[model samples]
Target: AQSVTQLDSHVSVSEGTPVLLRCNYSSSYSPSLFWYVQHPNKGLQLLLKYTSAATLVKGINGFEAEFKKSETSFHLTKPSAHMSDAAEYFCVVSDPRASGSARQLTFGSGTQLTVLP
Candidate 1:
């Protein structure tokens, strides 16, 4: 079974400082990974995704993630943190080739990011 683990349940950063959200994954096959952000009372937004292409993938709002096969890690990072960035983040794994119920996505518990001004 494919699974994702978010290292931190809560992360606090000062405004304009660098932000890092750590994630680790385990899968039986080469997996597709994604980072998603959710604002207060808002739906999840896709930050970035990796599908066996590039190791470093860029996403919306200056967020980026690097897929490291050796470490089984796909951690998200941003050069600076903004107040607007305070939200819930999720690490997700999907098996694109699977069918039926097996194709469902596996999501991490979630990481809440707090941007302190």
Candidate 2:
């Protein structure tokens, strides 16, 4: 079984400041991890993903995350916050080839980011 836990339900940051959103996961297998963002009244867009390729993954909008096996963490970080960056973020865990499994992607509760001007 694979699961994602978003450490924060809400994260607020001032425009031009740094932003951090934490996430943790537990999986029976190596697992594939992903970060997705959803704007208000919009669909979820994939921000970044870690698929056993590299420990450090970079995403759009200057966002990046380092996959830490020791800590089982994949925290998202942005060099600076922007007004457009305010949105809901999700941490997802999925095993595309699990035995007898549907290969479903499980999503976290979601982290709402508020950017203050």
- Residue pairs with backbone overlap in model 2: none
What is the TM-score of candidate 2?
0.94
Rate residue 112 of model 2 by lDDT: 100
- Whole-model lDDT, model 2: 0.93
- Model 2's number of clashes is 0
Off by over 4 Å in 1: 99-102
For model 2, give the 10-residue run with minimal summed lDDT.
95-104
**Each candidate's TM vs. the true structure?**
0.96, 0.94
Q: Which stretches of candidate 2 lie over 4 Å from their true place?
A: 99-101
lDDT of 2 by residue, 9-110 (tens): 999999999999999999977788999999999999999999999999999989999899989999999999999999999999988566555768899999
Residue 65 lDDT in model 1?
97
